[model samples]
Target: MTDMPLGAPGQRSVLRSLWQTQRVWLASATILAALAVFDPLQAAESAVFAVGALLNTAPFLILSIAIAAWAGATGADNLIAKAFSGTPLLMIGLGALAGGISPFCSCGVIPLIAALLAMGVPLSAVMAFWLASPIMDPSMFVLTAGVLDLEFAVAKTLAAIGLGLFGGTVVHLMMKGGAFADPLREGVGNGGCGGAKMRAPRPVVWRFWADADRRAKFGKTALSTTLFLAKWLMLAFVLESLMLAWIPAETITEMLGGDGLVPIATATLVGVPAYLNGYAALPLVGGLIEQGMAPGAGLAFLVAGGVTSIPAAMAVWALAKREVFAVYIGLSLSGAFASGLLFQLWTSMT
Candidate 1:
């Protein structure tokens, strides 16, 4: 037989690398196994619930990823940068609006930021998008509406835009005041830890499949996106099941059910650290609401968690200096509280 090609060694090396990098999945699997051995019924229920949740959200997730990938491939970002080029105030509003609709999480927004900065986009407009992008997206909006209600969904969208505008305006004023001078550190565009600037593929519309490279890229991106989302969602569903099974509704209601600034503030504080992915947070928040958590408090939790969650904060830390990161966090917390209060008042009136 012909000597075995060197491919086996290369394949083995690739397998080893994949195994090493899949620690999260390995840990999750171990925990699930342990749970099954110790409590089969609970484990089974959690598994079923996780699968159901995944299935329910898969369509929205697919749509969001497709749109994002298409935008990235079509050089739409260049157009976006041009739109906000000269008009600072309009940029704030439009940036916030764009961020709310775009299906980018905090981490996902970083590369886009890198691209915009590389192309000489204004920091003020970028700040607005950065502040709002994590809060919600089209897919997230649909998911939220399904879990909560149309009113809640609409309010959350507004909150996202409102927060973005607030951040953008503050940054613009600060820029005028000589703060944020040379905001980008040297080598940001070099694609170090900050993230690589998104490169626009050759323009292609419905004929994306006509290009072999584009087809491969689309497939890879879609798979990666699905896997990334599935991991968090699986964990979330498991946690949600456990909460429903063990935690008393009375506890959730007592803690987060009250109206007023106190509850809103409490929610904000609780949310900042405890928050996970937006899609993951949905079922948990829904459970809280069902347990009589105040709608306003729930909203506060979502907004706060969306903005200041560990992943989102990490992205900010990677991109900005310590001082700018601090302001971002502060603005997020304050905006969450204010939005919560407004929502509470509105709900009470209506």
Candidate 2:
């Protein structure tokens, strides 16, 4: 019944819209170029960093689009909402499952979540899934496994699942009968193609064939999403390159040495202000591990870095209220710390 428009209002076509968003790309590129002024080597270094990141992150972004398309086409959107209305256990399970699949970094997930809400997802469930997905993704696990040990991977998965379920249950109970449904009813409405009407669910075989056809027809769109995420990852690489060129790994290690809670806490605190994509933070974290930080702690830092950005907080505040935003922040922080602490304990015990 909502009158949300089909596309962003105006005369712009899809290509034009893509062009419009290039402002962010330009700004990021400009920032990289400016860093080159510090030294001539920096410019080539920046370009190489950007290109390398784009190559590395391409698979992750493709995976993200595939998941997103599945979610959209399957209409799991409503099911996710209904799960929130059901038992806390159901919601928790849903959170854990989504955490394992979604490829969105916390930053990317924010906008998608806002859309999900408009489509009728439950607030608590959406929040829970948002918190968990960045930390618990299979991609993250694979990446972690490559840098860290198998034990570290196991511990991180358990922590992510536990925090996701625990946090979802607690937040749901505390905010019982709260107004998470309000935002979707008012102001800027949900997701792209928001106003597009939904079609009846197609049969399984039909959907299988249809998806194949659509992917063929819309390959460019899928690639756009991939390219978009890659572009952001490239920016992150540029930042990492700068850090590597100018900053000393020893300085960071000296500031917060290995085998303690201080490094974890410092990493979390540092993450609160800095906004890096989840996959993007990997290179930096890998660097940290090379510099003598524990793998578990580096994982904790990467998880925290993506989830607790100011932009994420502000998005919550803008859509919901200050109180709701506070709860979101508080729960996310607790989730981050809990995951970190649990992994540390698990590591020591096993």
Candidate 3:
């Protein structure tokens, strides 16, 4: 028999390396097996929590990933790259508008923004999207509506959009006449480039839902995707569940009992670092309001916590230059304060 080709041997070696390195599969399998051995009631409760967490992030994760992959494949990032061709002032306006429409949260936007920056999108526009997208999106508006009064929702939404716009504008102004800071450092490969060479058209999120692939084979795709995305999602759930179980709703209310700048600032400061998802954030905000926190302050905290995420910021730092990353941090902090202050004033005046 002819000796095996070098290329085939090399491919197998690479595959083996990947299999050994990526522990996500192993961890997932272990957790699942452990769950299976638990008492019936405990197993059921864990299962329910797992399912809920899976469902909560699945919609956004799948859609965002699909959009990102498609955008990468089609060179749509170059379209983003085009934003840099314009004056900083113009790009800032464009960034503000894009931020207003994209409903993906701070974390969800990372992959998208990274892709845009990697493709050469203007720093001003990329930063704009980073600052604004979470605030003005439809889902946020829906949450605001359901969690607070309609007037409060409208005011919150406007303040969020304004923060994004203003932050972008300020950064652009500050960086004006400066050299462009390169965002993408290393050469990161585009979606699907690592595994296969197929040029098939990118499918919609729903299509990925129905189609068979490495993931969908035997319904394992759903399982793998859930496992891949579950780590951070778990943080949100565990914290929220604990807060629900141990922290009296009354305690939250008592702490925030005042409609003033101090209360709003305090809430915003506390929230910016917490990294709570909507489920957790809503209850906390509602509890504070029930305790007498100004509606605007509660709104501000929610907006800040949801939008200004440290984890996401770290990713931005890894992907972009120090200067741009610094700008991002400053803008996020300023925007959070602005949103908090505006909401506080509006609440006090009304």
- TM-score for each candidate, following the candidate numbering: 0.63, 0.61, 0.66
Better model by TM-score: candidate 2 vs candidate 3? 3
Residue-by-residue lDDT tens digits, candidate 3, 1-350: 87667669777897788766554345444554565685445445544765686576567777765555555444354454554667866777777777777667654665566556555555566677777776657776787678766776687667666776787777666656664444454433222122112223333243333444522432442333334345544444433433344455555555556866677766666565553555456767776777667776777676676565543554455455666667766766667767778767666676
Number of clashes recorded per candidate: 0, 0, 2
- Give per-residue CA lDDT, model 2, range 1-350, as digits (tens): 86546665543476477676675577567886686776667888778877876566455555556655455544554554444556757766787668756665544564455545555555566667766766656777887677665666676676666666776677667657653335332342343223122323343232533566554534543454455455555555666566556655445445544877877777666656443555555666667777777655775675565556533454465455455577767776666666776677766776
Per-residue lDDT of 33 in model 2: 68
Candidate 1 stretches with Cα past 4 Å from truth are: 1-82, 190-254
Best by lDDT: 1
- Ten residues in a row with the worst lDDT in model 3? 189-198
Compare the candidates by TM-score and give the number of the best one: 3
Q: TM-score of model 1 relative to the true fold?
A: 0.63
Candidate 1, pairs of clashing residues = none
- Which pairs clash in the backbone of model 3? 215-221, 253-291
